[model samples]
Target: MRQLYLNQAALSARATTVIRDADNQSRYLLVGKWGLRADVLTVYLIDGSLEAEVKQESLGLLPRFRLLYHRQPVGHVSKTFGVIREVLFVRGLNWVIMGNLNSGRFRIFHGRELIANIAPVSADGQTIALEVDQPDHEALVVCLAAILDRWAKHQQRGLNPLKNRGWAPGLSSEVTPFITQEKNLDRRY
Candidate 1:
């Protein structure tokens, strides 16, 4: 298995933005410091739309784990401490749900309704299945790619505020705008 490291600098620079209107008057964003832990980890949902709390579990000198999405926290098999390898998002009826690579589970709430849970399935080497209730695969993929691209750019720039390097360091000028435009289109939907 391949090991992943949490880019502390990138994590600290992580920021998510939510806009409500064209004037950008009602925009909300969450930015904070993040860390990784083997025993217990806490992930905070910054936007006003969601709230989360995570706790460590105990099993006879061993540690158990729980990840709480929204208001409910569920238990899962415990594993050794390591960096978060990936972040995943699935589009539901109303919400763009997020999850980590290890857990492989996500929840989406659209308005007051909770959509179906998404899971991965594989039948052969070439066939991969992402079980989603909605069929907007193109929009979903674009949104996820945009988020990941932003993260990658942040990581490549060393996430140093003092130096404040932009994404030009890692991506070609022509490709960057295309990515930004795609993300903007995704947000409109």
Candidate 2:
């Protein structure tokens, strides 16, 4: 197994994250961008060649992403609503991701075979470690990690801290910040 490390809490618009190998040598670079309707994330090799690209195609309850390797469609990753655990359906590659993705603990499986294992490397949850079964799939794994992190962050943003034991159910977390700002304004008035 090839052990890789991703040193980013989340990928934001205009942020670049580096994926390093076990020896701390940079293996890939993930550059994130804000698209007109969604987010775009691209992966490049250490030498600066485009390895793969992931574009968020939709921003609904079940988000969908398109994956490209060498600018060719490899497949797409789409989240499926589940009450027990997070599940991602990877078309084209016929892979499935199952487990608690928000916690950064999940496994990617291709059919009955295991492809990779992802988990937080630090207690602070700042760094994530990936153990991939093959070296050639490293680039794909990098792209998947970025998308997974992005989706997890998106889920968190929709949560309402004041409801459902810290979950807002139908309300987006964006309102909380605005509500806090309004409270500050009230105090000043």
Model 2 lDDT per residue over 161-189, tens place = 46646545456665453357877889998
Top-scoring candidate (TM-score):
2
List the candidates' TM-scores in order. 0.24, 0.78
Clashes of each: 2, 1
Residue 118 lDDT in model 2? 86
Off by over 4 Å in 2: 10-14, 34-38, 82-85, 161-189
Poorest stretch of ten by lDDT in candidate 1: 1-10
TM-score of candidate 1 versus the correct structure, residues matched by position: 0.24
Score each candidate by Cα lDDT: 0.35, 0.80
State the lDDT of candidate 1 residue by residue for 6-97, as single tens digits. 22233234444221222424322223322234333333222354333334445432234444455564323332345243423222223444
Pairs with steric clashes in candidate 1 = 57-64, 94-110
